[model samples]
Target chain A: TQLLEQSPQFLSIQEGENLTVYCNSSSVFSSLQWYRQEPGEGPVLLVTVVTGGEVKKLKRLTFQFGDARKDSSLHITAAQPGDTGLYLCAGVATGNQFYFGTGTSLTVIP
Target chain B: DARVTQTPRHKVTEMGQEVTMRCQPILGHNTVFWYRQTMMQGLELLAYFRNRAPLDDSGMPKDRFSAEMPDATLATLKIQPSEPRDSAVYFCASGLVRGVGTDTQYFGPGTRLTVL
Candidate 1:
């Protein structure tokens, strides 16, 4: 079973569009991380949210942790072609287990 | 840049052959994790180590898969008699564990394995 499920598994948008991806889970987590991966490379960490209701902004991207620590969200404003990649959300559950969410693959058309 | 490094970026072998993947975690990091990625399963955690000791490996198939940390810097995952279904991209990540857990993980360029 997937602990974390992301909505809209695949997304395609034109440049300058805005988008939001959601990561939901039934279990609570101590911390959550967001990563962006390009082709032929590993996922690169974007941001980490530790506290409930925490929000972090990285460049044109924004990451938010749920109030209950069971979900997270990633938002991009004025998307660019460089934002096209696989976005993954990972949570640190109890016992230090790292659970990755069903990734959201985004494609931006120039 | 001190990042995780993995060797044999691509490997192709026949079924029933043994496959070994190696990883070198970033220096001074005490935690190591192994993951496999595929279209069907996404990214699945296989095993993890802390301070050169295995902390958890329940996600790994014990029959044909084994993971070991020979030293603090080197971690290896081996598959004996690998099957066709074992073809996937294997990733290794390392992090520094604080009191709670590691939230930031630095991943390496995965090793793509194909078993025909």
Candidate 2:
């Protein structure tokens, strides 16, 4: 099993709809990161959450770290076609071990 | 913008051939990482180096895969006698690991390898 698991593996939503993506793991992390990747490109860093139960906002997107630091969530307000891409979450475990989740591919239809 | 750059955005080679992928990390970045992305495995870490020294390569198939950093500016991943199963999009990323959780890893465009 992967150290990190993200679900709905695939998401398709209409414009203006709100959606959420979840990343879960059995192991606690020192921190978690979110990245967005488009086709023919690399993943770009979106946000990094360090403290447990931390909540960060990036414009229309809201990111939250679970109270146990073993999970995270990403929520988008008023999704748009421009938001179509693959969203991946990464975990930083003890001893600086870093790993990425399988990722959630979201398609925002206009 | 100082970003990671990888050479030969795409590569195609026959089985048993040697394939070399190169990466030029962002200046002053102390950590270099190699990853392979496939439909099934997602993004798997092949190896990583800190301060030009290999820290971990457990995720790589040591039989045919090799990773090296000749200098701070350059990193390389080599696959000798690559098989069709080795085909995937390989990415190179560089970051400054300050032991702080907020450090960011900047990724390259990635090399699409197709072993025939």
Best by TM-score: 2
Worst 10 residues of 2 chain A by lDDT: A90-99
Q: Give the per-residue lDDT of model 2 (tens digit) for A1-110.
A: 48999999999999999999999999899999999999989999999999999999999999999999999999999999999999999998765667999999999998
Clashes, model 2: 0
List candidate 2 segments past 4 Å from native.
none
Q: How good is the docking of model 2, by CAPRI class?
A: high
* Alpha-carbon shift of residue A22 in model 2 (angstroms): 0.4
Worst 10 residues of 1 chain A by lDDT: A89-98
DockQ each? 0.76, 0.82
TM-score of chain A of each: 0.97, 0.97
- TM-score of each model, paired residue for residue: 0.97, 0.98
Misplaced by over 4 Å in model 1 are none
Candidate 1 C-alpha error for residue A44, in Å? 1.0
Q: Write the per-residue lDDT of candidate 1 for residues A1-110, one digit (tens) a residue.
A: 68999988999999999999999999899999999999878899898899999999988999999999999999999999999999999998876789999999999999
Candidate 2, residue B75: how far the Cα is off, in Å: 0.1
- lDDT by residue for model 2 over B6-116, one digit each (tens)? 988999999999999999999999999999999899999999899999999999999999999999999999999899999999999999988755578899999999999
